[model samples]
Target: MAFLEIDSLHKTFGANTALHHFDMKIERGEFITFLGPSGCGKTTVLRMIAGFEAPTRGTIRLDGRDVTHLRTRQRKVGMVFQAYALFPNMTVAENIGFGLKVAHRPQSEIKQRVDEMLQLIKLPHLGERYPWQLSGGQQQRVALARALAGKPQVLLLDEPLSALDAKIRISLRQDIRALQRELGITSIFVTHDQEEALSISDRIVVMNEGRVEQIGTPLEIYNYPRTRFVASFVGTLNILSGHVIDPSTGRMAVDGQELRTAQTLPVGDAGKKRMLALRPEAIVLEAPAAGRNTLTATVEEVSFLGAIVRIRTRVKDEVISLDIFNDPNRRLPERGQPVALGFSHENLLVLEEGVQG
Candidate 1:
């Protein structure tokens, strides 16, 4: 049996729905992430798991026990908020031991746990420092320490690194992943940052407007997206509208040019419109080789990013962003330069065409 299960979880506020028929089975010690844009119900799922918000319908089972209607304190769960909700008056040690203190543990046990948590967070010397005396990263560390101080059954982090700067966010997110692995804790993280989700999650649940678009490992989510939303939202994809020439053979006509996909294509009319997803890195700016699809394009813009040169080009009405490795010896193409893009038929992805989540 799974360690935690969220079955048909639904939430609504007045006339607007926040989450819809969400279902997931999480094993023990697995790190899952709910990834989506703002107001996509990722945080709402986290809140439901944390027992801070009651679901309008469905059930949440933890370790074989249903805790959907339990109060926050009754459910053995720890939560770290985006904002460091540490008390200003309390010292770092006090904040770390707040949960233990609230549970009415012995003073001696509380002290021992506080000392252990301080060492766990690698801030043993800052025990006496107040929240105002610490930096943003330090304050977040204190918040994380407090959450783990009680040894809860599960840990929930609601955009814990959103408030930090880019450098600090990267560093702290790595630390959080390392800590989670060390403790072997079952955890759920909520974030809109695709890079962050791809880096740290054991499995990613991609949500869209209260519905789940796809759920899979980072590589699975990136390489084989099931829907149009999954393909475009998770990474940079060039959406090309084409007419199906041979649905069974996965052949399509784009800009009066021919291309094929290795994936399954629907059976329909020969001129039916279909959407295709192609990654930027899949195309090489070179002449067409044997058994390759070639697209003629004109360079519209060139962006010189670090370690990468992004060449933006257009083939008819479709715009494609191609990323190439930066080379000091090679001169870049100027705007309005004509170019030919080549890619394999296997790299062309067939996206589901219809209403997106």
Candidate 2:
């Protein structure tokens, strides 16, 4: 059996359904991330696992034991919140040892465990300081340490780094991933940030309107999104309306321009209008090599985003965004100039037209 399993999970508040028929199984010691926009039910799933909210209908199993009805404290799950829920009056050591104290562990054991956690978080000398004396990043580290001190079966991080600055958030996320791996603890992280999820998770569960849209590794999720929402939400994609011309040959027409794709149309989807998804980074400014798809477009806008150059071009009436790595030798085309945009057929994905949720 999987270490963590959620089966047919459903949550409803009166007439509104927050989650529907959600199912997932996680391996032991794996880092999984629930990623989605606000009100998408990502946090609800985390809360259900942590026993903070009832599932309405579903079962949560941890290590073959049913934990759906267990109390939060009895579930032996550690949770770190975005707000850094540390006690202001308690010193770092006190906060880290709070769970052990509640469980009535021996005082000497608690001290040793706290010291080990402090060293693990790289703040061994800060034990004497209170929460107020620490920076945002430091407080978050303490919160993480406190969560892990109990050695819970699973660690839940609910946007824990959302309150920190960008640089600090980046730094702390790396630290958290390293520590989680070293401890070999099963962890679930909830975040709306795409890059964070892509960077750290062993697998990503993309959620929408309380439904699991797609669950896969970062590369699979980014390169071959199964749903239109996943393609649009996970990264910068050019979703263009097109019609399937020949399903057998993967032929399609985009804005009246015929092109061949690497994906076949779904059964009964031929002759119907569909949406094609392509990553901005997949587009090339120069003419493609032989056997590649090429389109002529007029450059509408150019934006330099540090290490990347974003070019907005108009093909027929649709605007397509293309991202190219910034190179010192490459010259950017001016607005209103015509340029050839080239991409391989394999880079294009034929996505479902309508929203899933």
Candidate 3:
């Protein structure tokens, strides 16, 4: 049996639909992320799992037991939100021990658990400090520690690192993943940040309009997105409108340029409409190459972005971006310089022509 299961869940707020028959299964000790933009129901799903928002339909199960109607306290699910939500009047140790205390645990047991939680979060000595005295990162850590104090069955994180700076967010995400692994806890993380979800999750569930669009490992979702929306929403993609031709020959035309793809093009010639999703970094710019995939473009703009140089080029009437590695020894092409764009057959991802807006 799966460690955590959300089956055909649905949620609505008056006239607005928040979730639509959403389903997910998380194995024991696995970290799954719900990734999407705002109003996509990532947070609504998390709230359902945390028992804060009851699902309008379906069941939530843990260890093969139904928990759909259980109250928040009865579900034994720990949660950390974007806001630290730490108690200002209580010390760090007191905050961590609050859950145990409310459970009617013995004084000695609460004290021991509090001490262990402080050490687990790497703030053993700062247990006496109030929330106002801690840094933003530290306060979030305290929030995490408090949630884990009682050793709940599952941990739900709702943009827990959204309040921290970039560097701190990265560091804290690593820490959270490490701790989750060490404890072998089933966890669900909700975030709009693609990089964060890709880096920290064992698998990601991409959502749109309260429905699951795609669920796969980070590499699968990023490299072989099944839909146009998933491909465009996940990362930087150069979308080219084209028509497929000759399924047996594996050939297509993009803006009058013939391209090769491993995928079988549409046969029977029913208009043969299709689209190609290409990554920016997959394109290689050269002076000229003897191939059909090469296109001459004029460099319109160049911008340095620390580790990479972003070059904008115009081909025909469309502006496309390419990222080149920064090298001190190499000379970059100046603005308005004509260049050739080349790409491999493997880099071209062909998908259905239609896409949802």
Candidate 4:
């Protein structure tokens, strides 16, 4: 049996629907992320799992026990919020021990658990400090420590690192993952940041408009997105219209240029206008070689983003982006300079032509 199961979950607030018929099964100790833009039901699902929001129509089972109607305190789940919901009046150690204290544990046991949690979060020296005295990252760690103090079966993180700076966010996320692994806890993280979800999660569930768009590992979602929403929302993609020439010969025309794809075309007749996707790294800003398709374009913009250089080029009427690793010895492309972009047929991804709300 799966460790956590959300079956046919549906949620609504008055006239509007927040989540629809969502279903997922997660194994024990696996890290899962609910990723999407705001109001896409990612948070709603997380709330339901944490027993904060009851589902309107489906049941939730954790460890094979039905928990759909349980209150937040009755469920064995710990949660950390994005706002660092630490009490201002309480000290760090007091905050961490609050959960244990509420359960009427012995004072000796509470102190021991509080000290252990402080050490685990590596803030043992600041136990006496209040939330207002701690740094943003430190306060968040205290929140995390407080959440874990109860030794809950599952930990739910609701965009915990969203408030920190980029460097601190990266560091804290690493710390959280390490701590989660060490404790072997089943966890669910909610985030709108694609890079965060891709980097930290064992699996990601992408949602939009109260519906799930795709669920897979980061590589699978990025490399072979099954839906147009998944393809466009996950990362930088070069989307364009492709006219089918001959399916048997694997021929197609994009931007008035002929190209070939090794992937099997969708069941369709000739002259079908299909949308195609390609990653920025797939195209090289150079002349085309054998077994590659070449597109003539003019450099429109060049952006040097620390470790990578993004070059935007105009081909016919469409703008395509290409990413290349930054090298000090190479010259940057100039605006209006004509260039050739080359890509192999297998690199092109065929996408269904539709809009996702």
Candidate 5:
């Protein structure tokens, strides 16, 4: 059996539904991420799992025991928020040992555990300082140490690094992942940032408008999105509208140009208009090769993003973006220059016609 399971979970506030039949199973020591934009129910799922919010309908099972209606204290789950919720009146050591103290652990044991936590977080010398004396990043580390000090069964982080600067956020996320792996704790992270989710998660659950769009590994979610929303939301995708000419051969027409795809169209989807998703890096600006789809386009704009060059080209009425590695020795095409774009059939994805916001 899975270590943790959320079955048929549903949450509603008044007339507004926050989550709709959300279900998931997490293995012991697995790292799962709930990735989505604001108001997409990702945070709602996290809160429900933490026992902070009661589900209108469902069951939460941990180690084969039902905990759906359990109180927050009974769940033994540790949570770290976006803002470091450190007690202003306490020292770092005191904050880390607060949970142990509340449970009436011996003073010597609490002191030993607090010192261990400070060493684990690499802030042993700062334990004597107060929260107000530390930087934002240091305060967040203290908060994380506090959450893990109790040795809870599960750890939940809700945008914990979103408040830190870019460099610190990157560094702290690496530390958090390493610590999670070392402790072998079942963890769930909630974040709207795609880069962070892709970098840290063992599996990603993409949610949209209170529903799950897709659930898979980072590579599967990025390279083989199952829905239009998943294609557009997970990464940078160029969606082109077209119609399938032959479902048996996977042929389609886009912007007055013919193209082949590796995907077999649905039985009744032939002759129907559909959307094709292609990544910016998939399009190549080079001479057309055999068995490749090629189109003539005019360069509309060029942007140099360190290590990569982004070129926006106008093909008929549609604009397609292409990314090429930056070569200091080679010259790039100027604006208004005509160029030929080529891409393989395998990179072209036939996605669902309707995309949810």
Candidate 6:
């Protein structure tokens, strides 16, 4: 049985539909992230799960029990929002203990749990400090602690790390993931940041315009994107358009060149259109190697990005991008130089012809 399930959950505000039959199943103690761009209804879905918003249609089941109509305070779900939402007038200890106190827990028990929560966030020493006294990252950690103090069944984090600096965001994400693992709590994280979702989530739900585009492990979403939107939204990819030359064999012709693919062309519209999705890391700039997809491309741009060198090449009318490890001894290729690019059949994904967004 699923720990939490959202079945055909529909939400509408006036004439605008926020979620269109959105659905997902979350396992017990699993970390699933709702990933999408702004105004894509990811946060709206999180709010529904947390009981802050009611769905227009469909049922929300928690551990086989329906909780669709439960109030926010009665759903037993903890939430940490983007702004930290810490009360500037309250100290960290008071904030963390607020939930327990509101529930009328004994003073000694609240004190003990607050102390443990502080220690869990690695800031036991900052309990007496106000929100203003703490750094942005530290303040967010306190917010997390306050949320966890309630010991809810599910933890919903809505872009909690987006407000922090890059360095602090990186560090706190790892810390949050570690704390979740230690506690074995089911978590639903919502974010638009691709890197953040890829690094932290066990599974990612790529949302677009109130619909679920794809849901899978990070590797599956990145390497074998089911649709054009998933391929472009989840990571950097080179989309090449073509037509299926052999409808029976799933061979596609790209810019007059044939490329082998793993996906069979869908029936009835076989020769109409086709496309291939290839990742930047999958394509390599090297001499013609045996038994690999080789394309002779003219180098157009070379960018140095610290650890790896990004090279843009022109193959016919389309510009293909590939990344190579930075080698100090190797001479950087000049612009307009002709280079052979190679990729394996496994790396080149044949997909339906569609514009990546």
For lDDT, the strongest prediction is: 2
TM-scores for all predictions: 0.96, 0.97, 0.93, 0.94, 0.97, 0.96
User: How would you encode candidate 4's per-residue C-alpha lDDT over 172-243 as one tens digit per residue?
Assistant: 999999999999999999999999999989999999889988889999889888677888899999887888
Query: Scored by CA lDDT, what does every candidate get?
Result: 0.92, 0.92, 0.86, 0.91, 0.92, 0.89
Looking at model 5, residue 73 earns an lDDT score of 78
Q: Give the C-alpha miss distance for residue 172 in model 2, angstroms.
A: 0.2
For residues 273-301, write the lDDT of model 6, one tens digit per residue.
75578999998777977767788889999
lDDT of 5 at 259: 92
Model 6: colliding residue pairs: none
RMSD (Cα, Å) of model 4: 2.0
**What is the Cα-based TM-score of model 6?**
0.96
| Runs in model 5 lying further than 4 Å from the true structure | 353-357
Which residue runs does candidate 3 get wrong by more than 4 Å? 265-270, 287-292, 352-357
Residue-level lDDT tens digits of model 3 in 86-158: 8899999998888889999999999999999899999989999999999999999999998999899999999
Report the C-alpha displacement of residue 228, candidate 3, in angstroms.
Answer: 2.7
lDDT score for candidate 5 against the true structure: 0.92
Model 6: lDDT of residue 108: 98
Better structure of 4 and 6 per TM-score: 6
Residue 39, candidate 6: Cα error in Å is 0.4
Candidate 4 regions exceeding 4 Å error are: 331-333, 353-357
Per-residue lDDT tens digits for candidate 5, residues 173-200, read: 9999999999999999999999999999
